[model samples]
Target: MLQYQTIPVTPFQQNCSLVWCDQTRSAAVIDPGGDLPRILAEVKRLDLKLEQIWLTHAHIDHAGGTAELARQLSLPIIGPHKGDQFWIDGLAQQGKMFGFPHAEVFTPTRWLVDGDTVTIGNSTLQVRHCPGHTPGHVVFYSAEAKRAFVGDVLFAGSIGRTDFPQGDHDALIASIRERLWPMGSDTVFVPGHGPESTFGRERRSNPYVADGV
Candidate 1:
């Protein structure tokens, strides 16, 4: 079975997941917003090799500490290409605007596309491009685990805000309904923030989904 642990990092409380295969001890770090020390500690505690760092989107809170973590672990960074390249390139500016102590932009070693698969050890995480919160937003789905790491595109009882630059309300809504909802009703959703939820639960209870449904 695949083992998963979530470390809530940075001021945004982004959920950074450390997923590993028990047999191979190979792991992927998902959305390392910050707290490099804690991430490293978990890697050590789990006795796993950090193979790659994956980003759900390029927002400051999601990609801010990627550079430092990659440098320390010497792991490749991977992310979808559709979202805010401008935001990824100008992370420092976004950090300054938000009053963060420091922020640095780190280019991904690989740009993900729809249908791409990220493999670590015995598992594969399929990339689903669900653009709405940001133009290039994506979710990582592990079919075997019946889980999806949905970035800012979704939340517990709500969806991501579309007030940011390049954010589109209609597009966001459509993406969630078309791309995410079809994943499976029982898939567990590990969002960018807040508590975990299921696609089935969100589809029925989320106001955004209710409006769309």
Candidate 2:
């Protein structure tokens, strides 16, 4: 079975998930926003062999601790290929723009693309290129687990802001409806922030998904 734990990090309380296979103890870290100590602690407690660090997107709150943690764990940083290269390169500047403390950037070892498969332990997470929140935003879906790690795309009762430099409201809506909604209403959705929700719940209640009033 695939087991998982979420560690909320940074001032934004971004959800950093540590997912592992019970049989092999091989693990992957998703969205290590910050709180390096806590993430390391969880890895130690779970006795997991960290193999990869996955970022849902390049936003500071989502990818903040990536460089540090990847360096410390000697793990590869993996992300989708569609996000703004400028945003990834200018992480420090992005932080300053948001009044956040300066942070450094880490080049990803692997650039994910749509339909790419990221292997962890005995399972594989399919990459869905669901842009909108950012130019290269994506969600990692595990067919075996029936769960998706949707980063800042669709939140509980609400949705991600589309005012960021490369954000697009129409595109985000299209991505969610076409790519995410098709995952089926029952799929468990692990968002970047806030509580866990199911695709069905959001589909029925999310204002963005609701039919025109």
Give lDDT per model, in order.
Answer: 0.86, 0.85
> What's model 1's lDDT at 85?
80
Candidate 1: lDDT of 93? Answer: 88
- Residue lDDT tens for model 1, 1-213: 567898998888889999887779899999887788888999899889889898888887788888888887799999956456887888898888887658777778998888898888998888988887888888899888999999899999999989998889999899888888888889998999999999888877887786433
Would you estimate the TM-scores of all the predictions?
A: 0.95, 0.95
| lDDT, residue 80, model 1 | 56
User: Residue 189 in candidate 2 has what lDDT?
Assistant: 89
- Model 1 residue runs over 4 Å out of place are 211-213
Model 2 gets an lDDT of 0.85
Candidate 1 local accuracy as lDDT? Answer: 0.86
Across 98-144, the per-residue lDDT of candidate 2 in tens digits comes to 76666788788988888898888887788988888888887899887
Q: How many pairs of residues collide in each model?
A: 2, 3
